[model samples]
Target: MNTPAHLLMGAAVFGRPAQTKILLAAFFGAVLPDLSLYVMAGTSLLILGISPQRVFNELYFSDAWQTVFAIDNSFILWGILCLVAIWWRRPWAVALTGAALLHLCLDFPLHHDDGRPHFWPMSNWVFESPVSYWDSAQGANWVAPIELVMALACGVVLLVRRVPIWAVPLTLVLMAAEIWIVRQWLFFFTNS
Candidate 1:
């Protein structure tokens, strides 16, 4: 998934919020998985920034990215964040973890090359199908199915919780918009 998809997932989980720190924590938690890639591409940069490649690599092992951040790490991190948030962020932890977990769940359909880490530490497994972008469909991978799910799930929960009924319609619209956005981003609008 791309950054927009991540933002969409995070937004769906934690909508326009009334809280700040919780929002930051959740936002960071949701993005933590991608940070692994930065670590990978960035081991060198960090070596430059911090001036120590061996120490940086030793502090955060390369395989850790392959295992922890590669697959389901965001969900796991969100779980820990949720528990930790309770001590600091209270009920907001619910929203925070929701966004973070949703980030991973959203990545499910778009996982590139079937190289998804669903079980994380349990297995460096990758799930791919012709239906998914991971199989490298004809430029169809840009569409973020997770956004649709997130919007739908958020709508359902909002309805059940009696959140503003207006949210349902709005979310449905968002889903459609997301599909088009993904298609455009993956194929048309983006520089291929």
Candidate 2:
């Protein structure tokens, strides 16, 4: 799933309209899993002058990078945090961990070759699902559309709940970004 979709889903699931802190936590948790990827890839591409092919194809799967991914995408760690938050009776923490867990759960099956070791410390195993959100060879043609629809549905959920008026434009922009990315991927697949 795209990061923007995760953000929308997280907000819809764990955020309360009037609670800015909880909403921010939801957004942070949603993006946390993918944050490392962005930072690492961005640095490599921008600072190191690396080619996109090398940055994505080679560095992305490097052991060091995968190890970092394992920790962030770890189900055990997030579950422990969630439990701790519940025990401590911290609503914001609960929202954060819950959003993170939701992000991992949604990402669990949508990844094919690029699957992360979600079950981290417990195991370094990555589940390569039959469907990928972006890979055309792995049913992304159908899967991506469903994902987009779900993301939009999540947006509706947020709107219906009456989030701030400012959020409407942000949500629209995110949806548009998702649409553009999916279209780009589909075009690349068809052209290739």
Per lDDT, the best of the predicted structures is: 2
Q: What clash count does candidate 1 reach? A: 2
| Residue range 1-192, candidate 1, lDDT tens digits | 654446445754675452455445445655666676666557655555544555345534456545645554544545666678666756556666667677777666565453446565555666664444322353444344544455446544434543344444544565566566656655553434
- The residue-level lDDT of candidate 1 at 117 comes to 63
Each prediction's TM-score versus the true structure: 0.54, 0.95
> 1-192, model 2: which lDDT tens digit per residue?
988899889888988743778877877888889999999999999999999999999999999999999999999999999999999988889889999999999999999999899988989999999988888898888888888888888888877887777777777887788788788778787535
- Error in Å for residue 121 of model 2: 0.7
RMSD, every candidate, angstroms: 8.1, 1.4
**Clashes by residue pair, model 2:** none
lDDT of each: 0.54, 0.88
Residue-level lDDT for 147 in candidate 2: 84
Backbone collision count in every prediction?
2, 0
Best by TM-score: 2
Local error of candidate 2 at residue 176 (angstroms):
1.4
